[model samples]
Target: MAALMLQGTGSDVGKSVLVAGLCRAFANRGLSVRPFKPQNMSNNAAVTADGGEIGRAQATQAIACRVEPSVDMNPVLLKPQGDRTSQLIVRGRVRGTLAAARWREGRAGLLVDVLDSFERLSAGCDLVVVEGAGSPAEINLRDGDIANMGFARAADIPVILVGDIDRGGVIASLVGTRAVIDPADAAMIHGFLINKFRGDPALFDDGYRAIEARSGWRGYGVVPWLADAGRLPSEDAVILERSAMSTGRRVTIACPITPRIANFDDLDPLRLEPGVSLLMIPPGTAIPDVDMIILAGSKATIPDLAFVRAEGWDIDIRAHHRRGKPVLGLCGGYQMLGRSIADPHGIEGPAGTVEGLGLLDIDTILTATKTLERVEGIAGGARFAGYEMHMGETHGAGLAQPVGHRADGSPEGAISADGLVAGSYVHGLLALAEQRAVWLARIGVDAVGPDHGASIDAALDAIAATLERHLDLDAMLALAQRAGHAATNG
Candidate 1:
């Protein structure tokens, strides 16, 4: 009945990845393990097979544990929006938007529901490994903090503080983090794990002792830097940085790095292609004359649309259309290419009117009723099956219907005239081998070199195999079992 919480010294300290590793490790021990994050801030989301929304990290963790993902895994998801506001998702659906200050003041009331979900999941599982967001030492925002220390404190779960030594000053980072957290919160950290250590673990022997000595915390093990994580479906938008092109072929995509980008995973399949170079042009970068320009999904579509206009990318996109280059949009990106996007429910921004790029002549009205479903659809005359989660509806006579069919052979997305601009609510449309290969072929890039899904699965297996080599699974399970027993007693 006890849970073990994994807290990091800071954000991006490998907490998510470590939690995933632990989940796989526990499952390998024949224990039914589940992953939990009371709250998460991520735009990379995954639509469960049942049509619910959850953080992609949790989804990946579910994959690691070989289980189906549910909303209980990540009860609260905060996706950043422009102007100090964020789009809040609760119980796998969009609740509304709240400024950071307002959210902090109002979120405490929701912790009960979050704990209810956790309790429900914990009841059915032999072990649950909870992942913490950000850092426990963020003193300023700890009042309503149910994600890290707060969640651990509420659940009475023992914590394993993971620090990134590769980022330098691991000892200081761990010790300082421990020093700043409130006493009650700090007491929950039963041990610490040094992750992403590059060089010899023996060389940092003194540093490990320094952290243990300085913080008075136990050292689990120094996990080496894992390079095989490429095998998993990435949940971080920053993964686009690794996309490269082969010698003669390339895929040119213009993705405006807005203040709140979401569902950026739509570009993943392109990154794996040796012949495709996925170019994510920021605001000031010239919209290069490329084969295609992709408008990715966004959490804050209304404002991000204005951003596209402000950065003059809208003009560039229009030019690309005029020049007969192919352009594709997904989810929010699809909404932006339409004639108009109306926010009647104040979901994304202040209740207002926003004009779309007018490329599709469709009008989308934002509604409180979210459209979340696992859809099978057609795109560019290809059969594609994917999930769709959105809050807007599009309708117009000039709108182009879907080109692909679902499992039942039903048409699902919108393909414009001349088929130059295509839009879909599906995020992973390219994960299908033929879909990607055909898209790449259209863009003058060859993508038939490797099967994308098999390659990704192999990569995930490699990451798991690598971590299995580095960490002691038996020791970790013993740690969790000890924590769970203590939690039950407490």
Candidate 2:
């Protein structure tokens, strides 16, 4: 197979976005390209066109490739539910939960599945662009690893190490990775690349040479921080660390950052609205006064419910609703807005029942079976599409006033009697232009930007154009082909 993997110096070093950009850059050149990550640890997921679920990053990368996303793109997805346990979803279906110890012990066996998926994808693609999870230098966790260098060594895939100069000491980062990993593992790396460069590349001329000199790996071009990066969906929650509350937009929307928040990218579409100011209400801070209060989804609904109560956000939500301000909930957040949540089977952790925020007349019962599918519906008289990935089934009088109807003509979601509060299991409710415009009109705002999907499409094209000018795509493709030939000869 013609392939190469991109591994980062550390987590959140922009590996996902870079791989996505490279995928688009190569696809633009008329090559059949695909993106793969053997294993991923994220709660931000997207439903594939094939009626399966995968990490949102891979789905976005698939978009860059102008193809429908498949579950094989991300074979193993670990969504953290608590400190030492996560819900494992393999090939788009729930495989069950694994404790920290069990996960470490069983990860090696999963390599078979990961490789199976990779090989299947590689069969038809001209170039399979692989992305590695975390850093290869974390030797402590290298044993039985399938995410980084371990997978590269297993698949005989060449690698290009990426470092974040924007984080400083990238020269040290690139060199130090070579210094830390086994020499055999280092041999798998064909070159190094510096990413998120801010100023002129000339400023890092010496630094670039030093990294190449120390590691004996050729330097790929330095990529400046793409200002349009915000237009893309984010894979890491760390970006929420410094999420600021803006002051100038005509309408303000706030969502409290729950500890185990999932699919937070639902807020990305809000960024496209020039008249909207979006904010991530940080912990220890009370919910700010805003036009709308969104209860973001979480991987652990019960625990995050307790978390919301502990932070007194439940009180803030009630007060906001009393003031006649709109409150919207998606998935787990929808569960939280109900009168109660029952988890008798311990499906998510120590089985128990918890009281919800009681803003809406509804009850949710957690179950072992999870719903994962792409769906389209008409809500508030506007047609929109979204996905469902939840383990709870809600039923109550609220169902009578369904917010919408699914493609199958089944009732979905709910709008309160007064219509000031709404909740749903949908994740991408406002991605469509008309849907977003309707949402804004509900808040009495008369502004709506371009179609959310179009914005993302244009941004992908921009990123491809950017990489075409900066990165040496021709050389990278040549390197991948050369490696394949060398392996065949050997």
Candidate 3:
């Protein structure tokens, strides 16, 4: 099977976005393509079509490939549980928690599972585009590493390094990587790609050639900052860039960013609304003036819950609700909006109960079983498609008035008696055109913006067009599959 892998000089060097763009670019050429990541560490996750969970980036890549996401796409997933320990997910199921120190000692065996998943995804595909985690330059983590060079060596996949030029010193980052890594590992990388370039490319021509001269690697053209990249959902990092809600918008919405926030991409559609001005309130800040406030999902709910109270956001939310402005929560945030949250089994953390924001007349209990599914529902009288990913069950007076119904006609979410407060386990409710319009209308906006899904498709196509125009697609494709380097041991 033919495959190519993109390994970064460092994290956030646009490796995930580049792999996603190439996946779409190749798929658009009528070639069957699949996206793979051996390991991913992020609280942002996507529930697979088969009722499993993987990194959100893989799911975005799956959308680019026009296929349903599967656990095979991301073999080992790591969800940070606040402390040094992480909850390990293998092939979509929880494998229990592992501390940073203990996980390193046992990860070599996990490579077998990683490769098995890659083998399955590689079957019957024209090409498989793989993404490496963090950077392979850290020789300290090289022994049992299944994320970067080790995975490439195990799978015999060709590697192309990527570096962010916008961050400056692209030449050093690329050349420095070659200088530090083992000779065998360095030999595996055939070329390098410079990403996030802005202004004149000719200004860096000497630096570009210098990278090739020092590293003995070919240059794969520079990629300017993608203009349409904002339309796509970011996978790993939380959106920290905050500004005032744009003036003259009919509705004002505030979404507070928690310390361990997860799946905040659910708010992407709202940012696209012309009549909606969305503000991302940072931690340790009071909720600002707005017609609506949405509490986003959190990886560590109890701790984040305590954090919210410590920041006095609980008072801010209650004040917002008292003014008759709406308050909404998703997943973990949904658990925090109820009367109380009980972790009797200590599924998330210590076994105890915490007082909630008390917006909804409901109580929740954390359990070991997690619900993962993609379903359609009705919200504010509009049919919508969304997904459920949570591990809590709620029961109280709020259940008497559900916010919507599932595709299978089961009730979901809850709406307050005064219609000013609600909480739901469903995510991506505003992504669809109808639901977005319904939400806008509820907040007194008369109009809705363009279709979110179409906008994303257009953005993906624009990225592919950029690749076909600026990058050497054929040469990169060859580099992806070509591998002929003698290596020394790490």
- Candidate topping TM-score: 2
Q: Please identify model 1 stretches exceeding 4 Å from their true place.
A: 234-249, 350-352, 378-381, 408-410, 449-453, 488-490
TM-score, candidate number 3: 0.96
> Which tens-of-lDDT digit does each residue in 384-449 have in candidate 3?
887888877889999889888887888888888898888888878778888878766767885466
Model 2 TM-score, all chains together: 0.98
The per-model lDDT (C-alpha) reads: 0.79, 0.89, 0.86
Which tens-of-lDDT digit does each residue in 1-490 have in candidate 2?
Answer: 5898999999988889888999999899889999999999999999887667899999999999999899999999999988789988888878888999999889999999999998899887888899999999999899999999878988889999999988888878899999999999999999988889998989989988888898999987888889877899987899889688676788899999999999999988898887888889888999977899998889999989999989999889888888899999999999998889999998777788888888788999998888888889898789989899898889999889888999899998888888878898888888988888888897878656777778888888898888888888888999887876776687
Ranking by lDDT: 2, 3, 1
Off by over 4 Å in 2: 487-490
The residue pairs in collision within model 1 are: 2-484, 231-459, 231-460, 376-406, 378-404, 378-405, 379-404, 402-413
- Per-residue C-alpha lDDT of model 1 across residues 140-175, encoded as one tens digit per residue: 989988888778878878888989988898888999
Per-candidate TM equals 0.93, 0.98, 0.96
Best by lDDT: 2
